[model samples]
Target: MATNSTVSLSMKFDRTSILGSGGYGVVFRGEWNNKIVAVKRIEKTNCENNKGEDALQKLHHPNVVKLYHVDSDIDFRYYALELCQLSLNQLFNGDEAQKNYQEKMPPEKEVCLQLAKGLAYIHEKGFIYWDIKPQNVFISVHPTDVENVSMKWADFGLGSPLNDRGSFSTTEHNTRPDNWLAPEILQMKENFNRTTPLRQEGTVKSDVFSAGLIFGFYLLKGRHPYGSQFNIPANIVNNTPVNLKAIEEKKHPMHAIIMDMLKKNPNDRISAADVITRIANIQ
Candidate 1:
């Protein structure tokens, strides 16, 4: 019978190659106990005073990446995780094989359904997945069927637990990437007032906005809903509406649902549960 394995300095694995790198740390493909796995190496300084490790340890959904083990030395922390074949970003913009595979991508409804299920589980567990871009969504082959693939949410480093009011502060990370930010968050930054409570800067709706952007990008073939303007961030900050006419003409069935998720007013945006229901209906 096959069983899960763990790794450590004493039980070391060979780092075959680097999978990717970002502000957080580097991910590498590794071989452990004769099985391939992903090894994430994060500097101790980068992970200090953060709840990411705790968050990943507690998360156990099929639609979320599985953490096999964690080990650390004086300088760095390492996470042994299930190896995913590709990220949604890679499928859209990676090498020739990855690009070619996009043509065979799952339907948008199915993709969103998986994402919404993951988000629902996260929200139910009292964490807000602040990051929901394509790069954070991974594609993996089914354990029993080599021909089947599924999407799993990855990279929970930026996730935060909901506060007393079911919201989280975005003040500490002021320079977050603007492309995926919700309008309210941008507005809060623009109209910064010391008297205003920092916790009000973000809510569950902010995540919905980011997820909507991912769906729109997928439907539009990697283009931002606002098109390729140099001032895209500024436009997003100002709550410039995304024109959905093109997607509607393309007969993308989720156009209405995407627009609902992208509402300028956080109060107007649809909840992750609602998104799941809507997508399930379509499917």
Candidate 2:
């Protein structure tokens, strides 16, 4: 198990150190044992269904964020985690790092493989990372090799366990960005309003869809496979075809795997593990 030093040590944080904030909590940059760390302060009420802390405690992987400690007070729960340099969203879209990311873009196969490995590990542990967007994907630069950077999956607040039927159901429609969500999720939300029976439940494959889009966005240099921001949700729901011509022209090996992952039907999508397998020979 990872160390839990929060109880024995006194750590301080404030709003000024916030790195990001979401519906669940705000993450602050702080120091622990002379090492920089991220402290997530989430209100207790908002964490009733959050599986992030518990899941992080059990999941230790190169591609998964490390949890250093957990602490709680009368009103909020605090999590001490490894501090990453920047999020995928910041690296890809932020003004400060845009030029840097473009100049030193990590090899496509390596990044895709690492991300798929993380998702596969989560699935192997019987959990689904319901949110797999650029914001939740973090990047860390190598201490010795600047050219060698690593990526990891973070923020598991929206995650859930896969039941005996290999799926889970939720009524929360506003938990994720519609453009980044799986088609089945959007369909369920639409059906719920009409009191129609759900045809498909959330599953690991749904996560695959989101992950596929992220990988495509990264490989395509910020172009979404599903068209523009306003059109993504509709395109996904309508099963609109994706245009990967830029990558296809370059003969990118992961192109086919990404296509399989973005299939509208959850059943048609490839498993995270299979994604790793398909890319194993890339290098």
Evaluated with lDDT, which candidate comes out highest? Answer: 2
Model-by-model lDDT, in order? 0.77, 0.80
Candidate 2 lDDT by residue in tens digits, 173-234: 35567788899888867756434444446899999999998898888777787888788888
Q: Per-residue lDDT for 24-103 in model 1, tens only? A: 88888765556677878788887775667777788999889987777777777787788998888888789988777676
- What's the true lDDT of residue 157 in model 1? 69
Whole-structure CA lDDT of model 1 = 0.77
Q: Which residue pairs in candidate 2 have backbone atoms (N, alpha carbon, C) closer than 3 angstroms, thus clashing?
A: none
Give TM-scores for every candidate, taking all chains together and pairing residue i with residue i.
0.88, 0.89
lDDT of 1 at 181: 77
**TM-score of candidate 2 against the unseen true structure:** 0.89
Error of 1 at 255 (Å): 0.5
